[model samples]
Target: MFMSKNEPVSSPEALLQQIDTDRPLPPLEQWNPDFCGDIPMRITRDGRWFYQGGEIRRPAMVKMFSRILWKEGDRYFLKTPVEKVGIEVEDVPFQVISVERTGASPECLSFTTSTGEQVVAGKVHPIRVELDPLTGEPSPYLLIRYGMEGRLQRNVFYQLAEWAESHRINGRQVWTVSSEGVQFNLGEG
Candidate 1:
């Protein structure tokens, strides 16, 4: 059965592919931390990058320049320009996080970067659909700003987890913590 709008999509792989592949990814150093709200960051003793915004940083690995896409209601939202050591060749892959109700416009969360950073072009909003209470008919379609901030946070966690897994960095046990108190332990490969 198809998941509801409030539910997250099953596979992130398709979401990853939906990214604007033609558009060049931004350099890691050029990623603006402010792109996804205020993500607390710290330099690891080993020189690895760490996101200190939420408690998840204590256990899970965070990365830079990745993309995550999520679906909330009917709309779609994307978080990009993740900050990590080595994720992309030219530019970092942004996360396509959540798709909220349609017709809603959400603000873009901002963060600081190591050096030069690129500004995101255009605004991404969620899709919305209204159903009849009695007939269960879809109508009154309109997008609404849903959990934009929350989605961005989740995107960051997922990107880092994916990166860790790709390099065989014991990512399976990674835990994704969000400011909204959402936590998940990523499976190991």
Candidate 2:
């Protein structure tokens, strides 16, 4: 079930790490081919809930059920399950502000998830697109951005192609919408 604004979460890092360790990493081949390809999408724990950052006093976790893939040369799209039985899914609209693809991957920046949650209050924000440096000029790399409540301070970006390569998650090929924008990559740490 989805978490209530009154619930409590222990540690974000520990929670994420635990979920990562406990869940069976899906094979890359299993990932939807349409969702696959070289692109980035936001990643969240399958069952955990998310809360607002600073203002949220209670425990909130966003159980990410599916993802939206924003690829270049196409329109924006979402890849969510048919339905979430017990969870209450909120819809937060978002716009693609800036996107960048670099270092064999891509990242995007937009309204912070928490910010959207606070303003929009219980809605899924849109995924923003950034450039991909590895693929020559900057281009949409199929990335989605989401606000992480509870413990995360800043927004997080997820890349589908990178996620597939790392987790080996696989799926069938699907078509998506695209928009025009510049590309970029995250610099070295």
Best-fitting candidate, scored by TM-score: 2
Estimate the overall C-alpha local distance difference test score of candidate 2: 0.27
Tens-digit lDDT string for candidate 2 (74-183): 23333322211121222222322222332322232232232122211112423233335586322222222333222122222333223212111144332222112322
Q: What is the C-alpha RMSD of each candidate to the true structure, in Å?
A: 21.9, 17.0
Stretches > 4 Å off in candidate 1: 1-3, 6-10, 21-189
lDDT of each: 0.29, 0.27
Give the per-residue Cα lDDT of candidate 1 at 69: 25
Q: For candidate 1, lDDT tens digit of each residue in 1-189?
A: 112234434333444354543365433334442222222333332223333333223211222122232223333323444411221111111222332212224333232122112222123332222345797643211111223222122343344344332223454443321211222223333
How far is 163's C-alpha from truth in model 1 (Å)? 34
